[model samples]
Target: MTLTKLQKKFAEGIALGMKQGQAARYAGYSEKSADTQAYNNMKNVEILAFADELIEAQKSMLKRRFSGLASIAVDKTIDILQDVDASPQARLNAAKMILDYAGMEEPKQLNVTADVNQSNPFEGLTTDELRKLIDDG
Candidate 1:
């Protein structure tokens, strides 16, 4: 459901952390009715949904901004790693940061399972037999 301009303003104010009465006032509600309007608006499903949407949009924007900053930090670390005049310890730290950020600091472990009942096609073949089989194939 589309919200009216006042309802949208109330939702935005709430999303900005204003109290309901304050949000109602911000939405242009009269001073005498601000509290009553706020109480009523709180029960409005459309306003609540719009407030939630605003919060999610804010979260998404922050994530994108933080990611951009992280990329710049990684790039500066790369520069430190390549600087000839950087101290050995500093360069080592930078290299370690790059590796950690790239998720290469710890080696990944994998598990392999086999079915005991499965037959091995070449299990009984001798080396010369394997060679002939390969040649024929």
Candidate 2:
């Protein structure tokens, strides 16, 4: 159902956080009947739905704005990481910040046991042989 012009105005006012009576008055209802008008408007399904739509739109806009700000913040953090004149500690902190924001903080230590009976592939290899092996690989 579509809302009337005054009802649309009242919904807009309500979406902006005005009190019901104030919204009714802002919608051009007489001061003497503003309270009554407000009460009636509040019970209207169409007006309530319109007000909810406005609120959702506002939330979407804020989310987009915050996303842009977050992008700028991440860019600044990356700049700090790349700055040669930044202190070692500052660069380290920036690196950590970026890693944390990217959800890649350091992993916990893991322990592994090797079987003593297993033959070693590179044991007793000459240094030159190892170098050649690495080069070929």
Candidate 3:
């Protein structure tokens, strides 16, 4: 969806805020300045685009944080781009290797206690049994 000028401005501000937070750590400047500069530098649409990237990066960063893994996900992502070969065959090979590695790693499992099925009376019934019961009834 296309955003209004105001919406664009808001998104730009948010993007700037995220950038400021990161920049503040490296440069001895206030986070707010980063935000203001980001807003001022880009038009509404560019700001919105940047906002989307920022949100994705934030989500990835959060996932890294909660997983308690020590590696910097951002740095790794950068490394992947830096090492990318321009040739199609080479890139394809790299992609395959990455997919293989990712597939080899186990995904983290979540714990849940609640029994979710409450309303399905015939949930556990076999198809034949259900048909027979329906016919009998």
Candidate 4:
């Protein structure tokens, strides 16, 4: 999945923390609907895969940069959890810290469904009344 030059630039800009619209523009995508265009590009599977590779590389670099800190933090968190006198909130925080460090934390997806505007606006209307309403519309 090779990206064109513009696509490469767009992905790079995204990795560099630029907004999609700004990244698209930086990649020479000049359009009146730049935001929409950028959104479409970002949703492309190949582009997303490329971007993920770049992000994973950056994450690896950061992990190596903080190599020693991770183990120390995890050990301290385990100690906190095993302490009986720790506050409930403190224990919870320690749990979360370990989960986050282990990369087990993820945003939960919620599904919300609602029914609105269901009543017939022309309920109980006579034929003449309904015709009038349709004509008005």
Candidate 5:
């Protein structure tokens, strides 16, 4: 769609992260009425469609800029996983990296209870009990 000068500038400003009212004012819209103008402009179907295109274009640019980091991380983790000399903790971390790459974040259903009225657990223990606990640990 062919946009007027202000519409073009407004779209560009929005693409560059400006809020609607800010973009409208930057595009030479009246300062006092810019908020209303920005709201109305955002309601226009052509402007909405153009904004979608702008967002998708920016996504492509961003992906290109950061594309190599994921592969490098995966490769290093894989190497760690296959190395027999790696510490057990290190190998576990590498496995976690693979899970993270697959988008499997930690399991979320752990049930924990906190008793607000409960005093410190160790406060009731005698000195001998504390010494035994510390020695066991």
Candidate 6:
């Protein structure tokens, strides 16, 4: 079976992570380490295959009532991105990174706020701090 575009992107992420000796944590499994070294060592084609299934699993999980797993997956994706070395133009890459993780088409608009709303109680917090708060809440 052929890999889709999203599958290709996911496979590339795994390959990059493996090359850097960084473990990819997905669905509570470490893509690195002795237990999962084989998975981490998968080639592009193999990873593409694995990613196809993983994406399907994530979609199914999202359809259920569980609201928290999706956020955990996003956090894991972000951690993976940070562990990998991207080019200097990280902003452009961030958008692609997010879409690739979510296995979705490009969004018409992203609702992210660049600056804090002064009216918000935690408006003074940095983006990093805000992200933590949002994730924790």
The top-ranked prediction according to lDDT is 2
lDDT of 2 by residue, 35-107 (tens): 9999999999989999999999999999987987998999999999999999999999999999999899698
TM-score of 6: 0.22
Instruction: Write model 4 residue lDDT over 1-137, tens digit each, in one string.
Output: 67898887888778878999998888888778668768998889888787778888899999999999978878999999878899988998998888887889668999999978788877899999988978999
Q: What lDDT does each candidate get?
A: 0.93, 0.94, 0.57, 0.85, 0.87, 0.57
Q: Kindly provide the TM-score of model 2 when superposed on the true structure, using C-alpha atoms.
A: 0.53
TM-score to true structure, per model:
0.52, 0.53, 0.23, 0.48, 0.58, 0.22
Better of 3 and 4 by TM-score: 4
Model 3 residue runs over 4 Å out of place are 1-12, 16-43, 69-137
Instruction: Find the candidate with the highest TM-score and give its number.
Output: 5
What would the per-residue lDDT of candidate 5 be over residues 21-89, giving only the tens digit for each residue?
999998899989899989988987887677778888999999998898878878989999999999999
All predictions: root-mean-square deviation over Cα?
Answer: 9.4, 11.1, 17.6, 18.2, 9.7, 25.0
Better structure of 2 and 6 per TM-score: 2
Off by over 4 Å in 6: 1-20, 24-42, 66-137
Residue 130 of model 4 has an lDDT of: 85
State, as a TM-score between 0 and 1, how close model 5 is to the true structure: 0.58
Alpha carbon lDDT at 134, candidate 3: 85
Looking at model 3, the pairs that clash are none
lDDT of 3: 0.57
Q: Write the per-residue lDDT of candidate 1 for residues 1-137, one digit (tens) a residue.
A: 77899999999999999999999999999999999989999999989999999999999999987987987899899999999999999999999998888778656698999877878999999999999999999
The C-alpha stretches of model 1 lying farther than 4 A from their native spots are 71-137
The weakest ten consecutive residues by lDDT in model 5 span 44-53
